[model samples]
Target: MTEKKDSPSFEETLSELDAIVSEMENGDLPLEVALGKFERGVALSRLGQQSLEQAEQKVKILVNEQGENQLHTLPENEQP
Candidate 1:
């Protein structure tokens, strides 16, 4: 089995990002605090996007005009 990462999972990151959005939308935080949360949310968004892209790449299947399906890993350069 693969070793677990120390970082938060994509789901958890999204949950935190949602909480930040809810808090910011309430319009109660001080400017500095809201700014900090906004930055964190942006970082989390990027992380989530990257995770999605990686997942998409991993599951890719190629079909040629002949209708044969090819299963393969990403090219060496694209591997994480």
Candidate 2:
């Protein structure tokens, strides 16, 4: 019987992406491994970005305008 591995949470993916960047920047990994890590990092980055975008669509940040809180829609997929 094979056991299924659980997917990492968003925070975990972000953390892994950060580690990958650090490892690549440190210039320690061999070319092949570095390339593999870069590819994985790109996928993880896209996943993280998509997750953030979905969450943003659900939540609205209220802005203070004319002394009143107004619903302010964030620019789509614009990272802070």
Which tens-of-lDDT digit does each residue in 1-80 have in candidate 2?
A: 22235756689989999999999999989999999999999999998887787666444332243454555558889847
Candidate 1 has an lDDT of 0.83
lDDT of each: 0.83, 0.79
lDDT, candidate 2, equals 0.79
Candidate 1: stretches off by over 4 Å: 1-4, 61-80
lDDT of 1 by residue, 1-80 (tens): 24258767889989999999999999999999999999999999998998887776555533344465665679999999
> On a 0 to 1 TM-score scale, where does candidate 2 land against the true structure?
0.66
| Residue 30 C-alpha lDDT in model 1 | 100
Specify the poorest-scoring 10-residue window by lDDT in model 1: 57-66
